[model samples]
Target: MPLILPDQLIDQEVLNQENIFTMSQDQADHQDIRPIKILIVNLMPKKEETELQLLRMLSNSALQMNIDLVRMDSYQATHASQDRLKKFYKTYDQIKDQNFDAMIITGAPVERMDYQDIIYWKELKHIFDFAREHVFSTLFICWSAQAALYHYFGVPKQEVEEKIFGIYQYEKKKEDPILKGFDDSFYAPQSRYTYVKEEDLREIPQIQVLSSREDTGVGLATTLDHRFVFSFGHWEYDKETLHEEYLRDLDKGLATQIPKNYYRQDDPQGDIIMNWRSSGSLFFSNWLNYCVYQETPYQLEKIKGVKVAKFGGSSLASASQFSKVKKIIQAKEDREIIVVSAPGKRSKDDQKVTDLLEKYYEGKKRARDLEVMIESFRKDQAAKRQEAQEALAAVRTRFQEIVRDLDLEEALKEDLDETFQDLDKTQSKDFVLSRGEYLNAKILARALDYDFIDAKDIIRLKSQDQLDYGESYKAIIKTIHKGQRVVVPGFYGANAQGDIRTFKRGGSDYTGSIIASALQSKVYENWTDVSGIMTQDPNLSKDAKRIPSMNYQELTDLIDQGAQVYQRDAIDLVKEKNITLKILNTNAPEEGGTEIKDQEDK
Candidate 1:
């Protein structure tokens, strides 16, 4: 119902004519907010339908946007009236100096001809280049997609012998920032006669295939430094527009199958299914909100390469002016498990972390579900910390009992849980696990007696401010190692490679082991609330026994019964990198914690 300035407008549209962050005229009855300035370069021959279709999509954004329709002068087929073009549209040269935060180039029906052959090809190219340099970001639809890709990235398009007209389904090549907030397997309306094959795009490394059909290839792109994005299919197509084409073609006796894989019944006269419309709108809105708005220069003229020297500095937003959506997450070209997050949750008010992380992976998804897992972890950590604290308190009580009794073997022997049958189950287990040296050593560290140093020097640090590092990122990750008391956020890490990395939810055990392997810790003590790996569930086994020590092989076997295991990742690292791991109760730091040594260490 409202405009949600997708990426493009989200950043650069802030202080310009295209700001979608306001209310529309229909809602004008209530408020006085400035509306977003939106310009559409309607290249379609049927101007009326294209106008209605595009306007419908733009009007639905969460942000407020006003539509300004800009059409090219008659360059090809004849359809729109001369008076309409003259009255409603202005050439790129006419609006060259006027700053727009966002713009769209619709697909025209001219695909059979060469790029240079279209009468307005040169003019259309001007608009294409101008949008990149001037508008924060531009969306080129169908014919425009081919023209712009060829013009901008040198990816050539060829006219296919058969018209690739149909309701084609596309598998996402990989999620891109522009497609943020989209559901998996989104569809776009395609009714074109030409194709831009992936093979043709290989030479230009800047162009990336976002989603492609197996038959037609390359559906969308956000390449050339992401200053330009192109959608080969019409995500903004009016549902009836395609139906109109199908019916029109059938009447003309032009051979056509009922827009393949479309309408539920595949009947030409069946009820039109608009399943793809929802995702299509979501994709476009995200692009405008995130890609364009966040990245466009604050000034407008610099895009045309004109220094603001004439205006005393204020033509376009500075190159640094656009708000950053997210840092680039580069995949390491080496041996290591790569973790990917789900499309991120947006910042509470005016934030786009999903956009940020998409930008992080260079717009290619590595591991899906990372974002949801991180959010879930943050929610659970508080409860975990409280459980740990209660355990620690009981451990101290046990330490005092041990000191007064002076019988380590007797206290350690005789069913440990039976010794504290009077306490609550949780408290009883905490009391039993709390032995002499282990409990007191940790309590010593807690009280700041400083018997040991936390190994933070080996792990990366966090800034309550920006968790991801800037240039200072290098200095922070360069400072981690063993015996150095340091605190690291459990779910995250900063690679020396500049991208901040993270682990699975509750993957602290895994992270600690990896770090230990990297440092080759002589004794990688992984402290937890448990005494050691317990054999049976306490609820299931009234007399469940705790196993003290086991080699990696034996421990991993027992751990495989669906319980969260540590040694899986630890040993993975140990075997690959040759390091050892130890499991200890942080509350009970000594108690000869499970020494999971390899065969050689034993």
Candidate 2:
């Protein structure tokens, strides 16, 4: 069977020219069987070139596949226009909720910087989390493999004194499905500035080394489950990829080395060897058949669910807390609807984020305030900062005379003022107070690579304090599609006039309830500090025990008696919808917590 792709893929003509069989989406839709859905997170700079290389490898499989191309929303590609990206590619936000049979994340030209220093590092991490729960199998290539190692296993990549640029030989270390048809050794292209220590990966119990070379360390590795596949060398690279890189590096005045074992008789002007194409095709085929097509559910929606999870302030207090929350979400593929609250204190002495925002808002605002905020946001490593500053300085100096009359500072101020010109005193206060949740949701959304759906955009209210459920349901349905994971700030919604209005201090639980009700979710999870509803407050009684299960009436009675585990309104909403409500602990999810239902199970 031929590969199935979008109707207007820009590289379809190129693939056709190479004798690759491909069918359009419209043509595939008429078929009775479901095509394997594959998502390609293309991170390479030359979008069209990388598309052709990857598509050629994917076409080797007998199973038909529908390809969805995704691009980084944070990084703008100078090589491709915005129109091309809009038409041909999707952002992580657009498909995070959707499940995939397999995913391919390509390498980028950012091996020099520290992983955290990359502009889209947080966003990429989100995609990594998504792959864990949403994708059946994911192939990470080159720099992306190094990134996956660091993100998933805490294995770091060390900067090599010289770039490993060549077509190198790799020996198979294991008899695995991925290397089922491979020989004792195979050749692939390697162009990288950093390498991961083989010893570090071997120490992790979950990871297995499939192939390696003495000079290149670990060329291929996978998790014990085989859900994640990593390749240090580029098997999908064309015969001329390295040649183009070499020439481009030379043009930039960098000391570049000729690719080894690539050109005929080692001559720069000679014909390319092109020895890796067969192996690349076989590898992709094995992955599709063994890792994805066989293991993924025939009905993709069978793996999906409308589960809502609400995380409180303490659960999102620090960066480490955010990482914990991401792992919790990854634990279950069905945990799709995520609700988040404002940041809490890092320590007993630290002020609450809401108070800090209120204080900042009540005080006089200055340009220096904006600088401080921007400085805090741009907390990249010193080396990266210096490099960026130097580059900016050079650009400014070059453009000094050409734009001598320009007032850069005034121009920046004007842009900032124009963005916030509509905020009045009341609206400004609401906006500032809401920033704690808005900013927290934004950070979490970037970290999870999921869509950040603002509550004001979907959570409609009839008046300042009353929710308009009818209108809100329609808005939520329109904003969120089937199979997408999204993050929404809690405790606030928009009134008829579109002014931001917040609920009581602990109203985030209510926000969670509304979303669960709107989506008609089967289970609404409230993640907090406590494991579940307790017979007694743990703070007051060291002997308090977690309630295993309770009926809706019992929960309401406890709420009437002043149990602060859930808001009364929130409980009522879920109760009316007959949705099971689970109270779980973010700190220790293994404890299992408590469950509330309309009636106790016999």
Candidate 3:
């Protein structure tokens, strides 16, 4: 292997495991990048396991990342052996002179203990002072969070009668660097019995609460200066780590509570997978990208200063508003994109858009047009069948374990029927899957907190209002470019006479790309769940290295020549403009998303 590993390693294994590292040979060759340097202080019970978990989260970043383990000898948090620490851990004395781009302190089993009583309290205090003055940004997890919080603010830890175990829902506290691109509600794993109380932490004038669980206390917090981030919740933990702990405790005669808000049926015997890992990787990667990679000085700073530094400015404050517009614009700007049916249900238990649209079409009482729509609808129904098949595949093993002795054919038919019935009620695609794009935009516009003008406001742009198609587009573009983002629905037209006429499907992507090209943005950032462009199909490659940057022709070739990554019409919209479309993991924007541009073949 070269300095960087081959971007695609055992491609089949990647797809099989659903790992998001897939990359093409061209991407690998062009992106001759170096690994980011990170320091991890293991304060947990299982040092190496935590090491692998943290490294796994780091692995998803496009950059090469090297991990340095930091060990403290004074505490009873004996996760590592003396030999192992000597062999792999770098002592503070040896590394105090060096600076790191990023640092993570793992959770220790000392939260219930007093600060002065702990054997390593004095040394850990020194680490705290050093973190503020020396390190670029420090991420303190679990016990480290409590220790740092109390040490810096004198906010004390309170013991809990119950261990807060399992997956907990965390509401985003505020728009900050560490919480970028996170949804309103995301999951984090909490497995601690004690935490710093909010009232105590609130006493500190400089504390910034990033997130908090109503019952679990503060989920995450940061110094007002923003240099130190403390996550009371274990967002960096592996999905099943808590489960393992729970099971171990149960086996050891230690009282264990079933992880609350976990295991759908609330059955302790029910099977569960690590859904929280996705959120974990997404959150930490954002921290590394925004706080460490983007903000930290590339040059290392020695521990020469210990003065307190204050960090807040209009620049940081102003970014939150732009981020909303920027991320949506980015999600809009991708080509060769295969849009799934219907936008996701807005809420976990909301009706889909497709069903309501279908019902409305039926209510109009047009036999022939309704027939045509139904045929189109029936095809979507077929697609949903395939989707259900895949969904079933996901829990094939679990299905066997949970629903064993089931009738094979009858169950399959029943599953397919349920999937189709649900599809009928749910709106799958907005522009690509259904006609709900217009409706969705109206809702989304209201949901947003900025300037919005309906397309109807521009009468000339209406289908029957006597405006040219290009003219209406230009007018809408004018509004959007003037910093007023609006949605222009697909499949509609306004004549020179300003008469409205409707068109076919899939024009929204083209409109978005054209608008992006005209605006001369650096790159179109498309937000979606997966990481950027891959070498083989996501189904084809598993450990597909997420491509960093790439050429345009290659992108087209990938889409055109068997890749099916995007639609050509959208690519053609900006081909002349040479606009680059970057596909980002909406879940992990700081993973340095993949960019698509015209390539220079070697």
Candidate 4:
């Protein structure tokens, strides 16, 4: 069974219990195209349970995924049936020669035992060594994460006083591509007897900590490049997984407590609250997208050695800037993907597209030159409605003029009217905010004779307005035709209800970074007003000089210090992918601008 499994044993149960569907019918139609080849090495003792859990977690994306189950060559498990292993699992030697887009190494039950004393330690080491060359990316979970960290980075794990078994709250240490759609705080299930110290990870320059909790130590960690991810939490666990573990321990007369923040009100007999399920889904999906799908070469052999460059656009505010961008693209054969922001102010007196939209939203809520404020929840008044209509009409006029100036034909009137009416019905501020990028992108696409793609159709956001990394990547790759010059609107995506939503301020750059990461562009060129990133604000100090280059860490420090070089979200999207980011000036395209590279690259 591959991407579109017709009747998996766990499909119905998972679908009913967790709502994890592999792909839509539309996505299944694209199966004539090659599917991502993924290999899962099941090291857990309860092979069948782990199989169902992992498969369910991997099933939500639109990517056509084919999975191969693997087992250690040196050891036989008495827990899993030998017949099942023979029928379904492939030994390491059988698949070691083949290449995989991604490989997942599951947690083993032997954490207290010494690494050298483990029965399959030698075989596991061999597989790990093979994965470096044979796999594009690898996800190491729980005990496996610990083992790999020890083997690769020489990081040691220390024994804890007691087994850490509960649903714990973890906060993101910093943003990473692997956390594309994660909230500020999330819940994850931890069941372990030993933990890797935060200090140990700090000593390793290559390893980056992702999620950590005060009570539980490090929850997730990854390498600088993110080709390898070490996850301490059981992100693929089902709702009752921890409960089942606790029950098993209690049955053996071993001391165990009820999982914390798990069962509703901490009563074991009460309903189990599934807080960690969404976080788990997001984690797996992100690893698949940013680490595997985006990094893996289309031609499997090409993965042995590969390089990438990415480029993007600025706030194409005026016809002058638009022409400059077009010239820049024509100058280079490699400029394939374009990220377009909303038009900015053409002059001092002119209003930015986003500002105009925000003004319209304000007008929609209140009548001009009146003491009374019009509320959306109340019945519409004629005078207030007239004010709102005039505001929308003004915005439409600007779009029409821009389209006309660009000498492009578009159904701006019809689409604007429809979208405006939809917004009135829904009263969604994001839908209003999105029109800035939407209109500009359409105009730019027509002007350049490129395909106009709505970010909503590709960039996916959850109900919580967080990005769905894997699904977003799949949507982009599947929807965007290969070798086509495509222009995507920045800042917005559709939520779970298919309603428009937007990112925070200066999100156009964030959108640009995401597009670059997904496309694996060679260099992400962020064209803006300034020459490049300056050492200090130009207005604050006339002596401020543009930095020629900086590493991701330096850039992060600068942003934290109130520098406005990029939106906070942009760096994380590109850093892990190793995509070079350049800050270039649209006015002076010929001048060499600031180049952001890896610390080693600089």
Once fitted onto the true fold, the runs of candidate 1 whose alpha carbons sit more than 4 angstroms away are: 1-35, 74-77, 297-602
Model 1 poorest ten-residue lDDT run = 307-316
What does candidate 1's lDDT look like per residue over 1-602, in tens digits?
45432223223343233322333345653656544456688878787667656766676566566556676654633797776666666766678667676788888877888877888876776676566446766778888888887765466787776677767777776767777777667777888888788767654444667787657778887764455677888877766767888889889998766787677688766788887788877887787678755665555443332100000001001111111100100111111111111111222342122222223232112122233466656445444444444443443344344333433434334333443332223222211222221222222223222232222222343541223222222322234421223323233444344333444333345444544443323344454445666777654777866777777778767768666546355456554433445554433434665666666423
Using lDDT, rank the candidates from best to worst: 2, 4, 3, 1
lDDT of 1: 0.52
Candidate whose lDDT is highest:
2
- lDDT (tens digit, per residue) of candidate 3 on 1-602: 11122233224464336453434445544765544557788877787677656666776775655456778866534555776667777777767766776788888776777778887777777677567546778998888888887765557777888888888887886888777878887888888878776766654434678778667888888864456888887766665677788889899998888888777687767777556777787787788788777766555553222110000111011123224333543443221111112233333454433444444334322332334565667655555455544443332322232123222334344543454454345432221133333333332333333333433323233343233434544454345432233444332334455433433333344434544443433345454445777755665668677778777777777777766455466676455444557666544656776777665211
TM-score on alpha carbons, each prediction: 0.46, 0.55, 0.46, 0.49
Candidate 4 runs further than 4 Å off: 1-31, 305-602
Q: Report the number of backbone clashes for model 4.
A: 10
Total backbone collisions for each predicted model:
56, 6, 45, 10
Across 285-318, the per-residue lDDT of candidate 2 in tens digits comes to: 8988998998788876664337999999888876
Task: Compose the digit string of candidate 4's lDDT tens values, residues 147-262.
Answer: 99887656788887678888889888899999998999998889998888887887554578987765677899987667689999898887888988999999999788778888
Which lDDT value does model 1 have at 222? Answer: 70
Candidate 4 residue-wise lDDT at 394:
69
